[model samples]
Target chain A: MDIIKKLEWRYAVKKFNADKMLTEEKLEKLKQAFNLTATSYGLQPIKLLVVQNKELQKELVKFSYGQKQVAQASHVLVICIEKQIDQKFIHDYFARVQQIRNTSDEILDPFKGALVESFSKKEREEVRVWATNQAYLALGTLLTVCALEEVDACPMEGFQPTSYDELLGLDKLKLTSVLVLPVGYRSTDDMFATLKKVRRDLNESIIHIP
Target chain B: MDIIKKLEWRYAVKKFNADKMLTEEKLEKLKQAFNLTATSYGLQPIKLLVVQNKELQKELVKFSYGQKQVAQASHVLVICIEKQIDQKFIHDYFARVQQIRNTSDEILDPFKGALVESFSKKEREEVRVWATNQAYLALGTLLTVCALEEVDACPMEGFQPTSYDELLGLDKLKLTSVLVLPVGYRSTDDMFATLKKVRRDLNESIIHIP
Candidate 1:
């Protein structure tokens, strides 16, 4: 099916059957899809934490405002952003560009110097916020991949972050949870499944030049 | 091709051929996708500004740090978050929910009360930031839709937001630019097209509990 229909076919499933679990290949596709998600400057400052342990999922349920989806899903995916963006990140990005693409310094030097100059001038807070925003881009991409793969998923942000970081031991990595996604097969009786997708009319949402 | 292939086939085009433009139908689908993107508490705290005017796109390129794609793409999609999340916004969201779902206040009243209590306690800046984060989620969803439909897109953030807010007249709406996306077909000569996708290994990026 095409994208719009895939989107129509997907919803934030309220209940999932635990007996059904995603196969390893399907899970790998999701990881690849998220890795390919576009990010500003290609920094890709996000990490995906996949939770399959029933005990850990149950623990996360507490931090997610008692959302049962966290505990019931076959897997809970936590998208986290690096806590800080330092000069090392910018330098490393360019260094990789030179190594992988095998492009000469002439082609890469100017871009590297320019990026470092621009990034260095920004306030530290702005840098962190910018990096976090990129993580959301990754989050959105993963959600659609879940839909396209016909996996029932929910994009959740109602969790307590400080507590989740503690529970997941994210503080050591200098990472913080930005979003939580639960992917699994929906139960046979989820009421939300039968509801219509509510959206504004196209006329109101789109401004055409013609 | 399925979503997986579409994602693998697309890239964040670094440069665009100014002459190529997207068809009206594709643009319409993008608009529909944006409207359907989910948000926190269903607040829908974001608005999109579609710019196809070349002169306007040229101006936006300045705000986006001289990125040629911003001015060359068939259109620029500016996603903005509401400057403040006040009682009015919460009321408006529920009103739309009621209208679209054909539901009664008795069913919605409790949820509405909870939202008011929650948002009221949040500092204005916190609310704004939270709302802005949702905007990024929506942006990511749109990017995936673009890929599924074979529409080339670039998610950008290296911009001067203050200037963009002023130029787009968003200050009056109390909306600030959170993300800017340039959407269209990629240029044949864009060198970034041939590069391999760079990502952390699946084992490194995803933690499996099983």
Candidate 2:
């Protein structure tokens, strides 16, 4: 379908045109898209940090292993996970579910209690891994949304998370960055933009069990 | 902009209509979409297993913790990762890159060698975690494509992966399933089809640093 065409046109843009800024309306669409992304158990434990200040973007570049795209792009999107995914998080999630669907506690309590109990027993690292996975899902969704909008984006995981957390004051916010995406328009001089995408053949990537 | 509408129209379907099946042409689109999903470092370490056999689907339901959607969907899509992601995998990836772009070995070797050396030094579990992250990215893309195509899908992580690997003989292929997606039409009687989605407010989920 046309989706494939959009996907084909999308690449991990390396050089962004910093002069071109995304309009407020387009940014609103991205916000809605991030909010709409489906998360594990609908917990939605991830947050998107939109960096528009050029000074802060420049500071982020050092933590990003000198990847200038973080500073050069119109906006840098940092995906972060909740620092503490405790019982309160679970309870708050179920409260929203109950409020939105108007479902009875009788119907929600069993599932809600089970999740709260199960997550409470898990180790911190285990919970972090689970939350991190959800962030990746959101990243994937945002990448597609950018593609369809004809917005150039570079999905990155090469940054120093601890440094990012320190610089962005994410620790105080109780969030840790897991993924970063630089979104804007591609520069005319970006040679990598014209390079053919390297992908496995369809037969190699998909196995049919009919 | 239209992508947001499709994203809104989509939901994690609870029950699928068993009588309706995805057409071959539509399935092909999904195959292309999966192959085209961007992965970390362009390694594309994930694989898609498309199971259409009714008997196998029935067997898979038990492993899926009695999730009837597993058996009821027209096809079950299992996202898997390579059992061993080492230097060989990285080398093969760069080979394909060179072949596709007709780039000189001089241009590809430095990046290729660095990736091979870095991944080879990582622990097995670390590599598995990295590969699994890529699988989630692919799952995210697949969910969006399904939405845009108006094909109902339930992106699932609630299944037993060990059982799936044993049943599907994925061990023989040196692969492990990370995520499962049941794609089909939603059943009319599914109560969840009408429920409003519970999501965090846009302001709460997004931090704007201007």
Q: Compute the TM-score of each model's chain A versus the native chain A and list the values.
A: 0.95, 0.98
lDDT score at residue B38, model 2, on the 0-100 scale:
89
Candidate with top TM-score is: 2
TM-score of each: 0.92, 0.99
Off by over 4 Å in 1: A114-124, A208-210
lDDT of 1 by residue, B1-210 (tens): 766778878888898878888898998788877887777766778888888889988888777878889889989988888787888878877777788888899998999999899989998888877877888889889989998888898887678989988887778778788788898888899888888766555566666545
* Candidate 2 lDDT, A70-119, residue by residue in tens: 99999999999999898899999988998889999999999998998899
Q: Which ten residues in a row are the worst by lDDT in model 2 chain B?
A: B1-10
The top-ranked prediction according to lDDT is 2
Cα distance off (Å), candidate 1, residue A142: 0.9
